[model samples]
Target: MASYSGNIDYLAPNGVKMLKGIDNDNPERVYICTPLDVNEIKLERHPQDPNRMVAKMRVNICPLSENYKNVVRRSAQERGNANVSVPTHEMQMSFSVGYIKSVAQKFPKLVEQVKEANKERDPEIMGQDPTDENTHLFKAIRQRMNKRLAMLYQPQPPQQPSPYATPNVGVAGAATGYVAPAEGTDPLAGFTDADVGDLPF
Candidate 1:
């Protein structure tokens, strides 16, 4: 007397149907199972569409008894083929933006520690004195702050009169026709290059 534990079902063109509770009166269409020695499982892709695909899976079914050996061998020969093995590796670390942000939030002391360490290493920033060894650092900080304030409260430059302000256009023409005395003439206007003669050469 043989014992079987696993269940089986029929996969048809219409749909899947259970075979366990069905009548076993027909010997020709009855489902049976013998102990099988499974070596490995194989998977393959469908022929039509590589992307929209199907798998061709196989499992080696070794026989426990001589009678079942032929059955298993026949099934194995019908289903089994050369299968490609897949390689997998263990995940070592998972670095994420959220994790980084969380770390920053959770360990602010660490951030402060790093900042303090950097300050210690740098020659130009000790406590808070402009004339100290860290004069350059203090100067840089002051300059940066000044730049920010200047950007915030910057004065607008004076706007120039538009070219179309006076519509009457003429070649070498002025808004007031008469040329006014050249305002504030240079005192050294009459001096020539030879006026300061006395070459050291």
Candidate 2:
């Protein structure tokens, strides 16, 4: 399958029947790939197409043990083919445009989390603000604490545009992107004085 894609059932050739490999009847033909972490999942262009809008993916599989990798290298060296890469079975899968859109609309929470996790990192946050401490251990702790505080107060990705921006929508047009904090805003908006583990409050 040079091109990983699906064909309609009606488009199938005559006298051809698909088998349900999931059945116990054919263990040899069925292959199982481990469930990969959603965060690690990525999509890349299939080598066959450089300018297509298709959704072919080249998943990055987990690395095997160094011993196993060395075995591959040793075998290659014995065969005078050190540059060749190991081969793995790849499954080509495709879904309709409707199916793709449905998956996105179905997993709004997942989509939101993925977007937030991958948002651009702050360009200004290089490290903890340097201190005049002469001790290396103290300097390291201070830098870690500075980074933690910066991450805690970092602004979130922008939310969708809201119709409530108009003056009549709410209390005088509250702009979605840049609304002044309402009167009587919580003085401690980002802090919780509650006990949290061994945190030095």
Candidate 3:
């Protein structure tokens, strides 16, 4: 008989379904994980709005701190499953394209890592046009250029706005924010982390 390792459901405060992204309640929690695979990043159309685009990727993270490990264990135990082992490896994380870009800008090394991974996965990627956003490999080049530019110019602190100033409201893109689907929606909903191992992340 084939053994079954069942899905472990991790809950946030108030039993809200915690799927792919980092737990909002524990913003400081840290995890150890490998670099993203070459096929990890993907461009997809937004589920709620057809005109918009969102990049959906899966991130496998393992709790790095002992306290966090215990928390994961406790969460599993609270689910009434003594047999279910704490998932110390391959916890799912989600990121929007904008967040990814921000990370790249802050940590320029990440852009190089992506490029190296792409070349390792397919040598042809090295020859692809860097400006093309249609392919994942070239997208990394674009991100790399952006990272370089960001490094060239350090950001200045934002100025306080006047009380009488009209706030600017911009349309949403994969450009900013953590989640993309909608409020209270999980990008990784309806699928276990194992299910999306080959999908994204």
Best by TM-score: 3
Cα lDDT tens digits, model 3, 16-129, are: 221222435554433222222222345577899998887544444433466766886688899887754443333344444544444444443444556677887777776554
Model 3 ranges with Cα > 4 A deviation: 1-5, 9-91, 127-133, 138-201
Error of 1 at 142 (Å): 29
Please give me the total number of clashing residue pairs in predicted model 1. Answer: 2
Clash pairs (backbone) in predicted model 3: 58-200, 58-201
TM-score of each: 0.15, 0.21, 0.24
RMSD of each: 42.4, 24.1, 19.6
> Which of the numbered candidates is closest to the native, going by highest lDDT?
3
**CA shift at 177, candidate 2, in angstroms?**
55
**Lowest lDDT 10-residue stretch of candidate 1:** 145-154
- Clash numbers, per candidate: 2, 1, 2
Where model 1 places Cα greater than 4 Å from the true spot, the runs are 1-94, 121-201
* Candidate 2 local lDDT, 124-199, one digit each (tens): 2222222224433223332222211110111334558656232211121221232234555432234232422212
TM-score-based ranking:
3, 2, 1
Query: Which scores better on lDDT, 2 or 3?
Result: 3
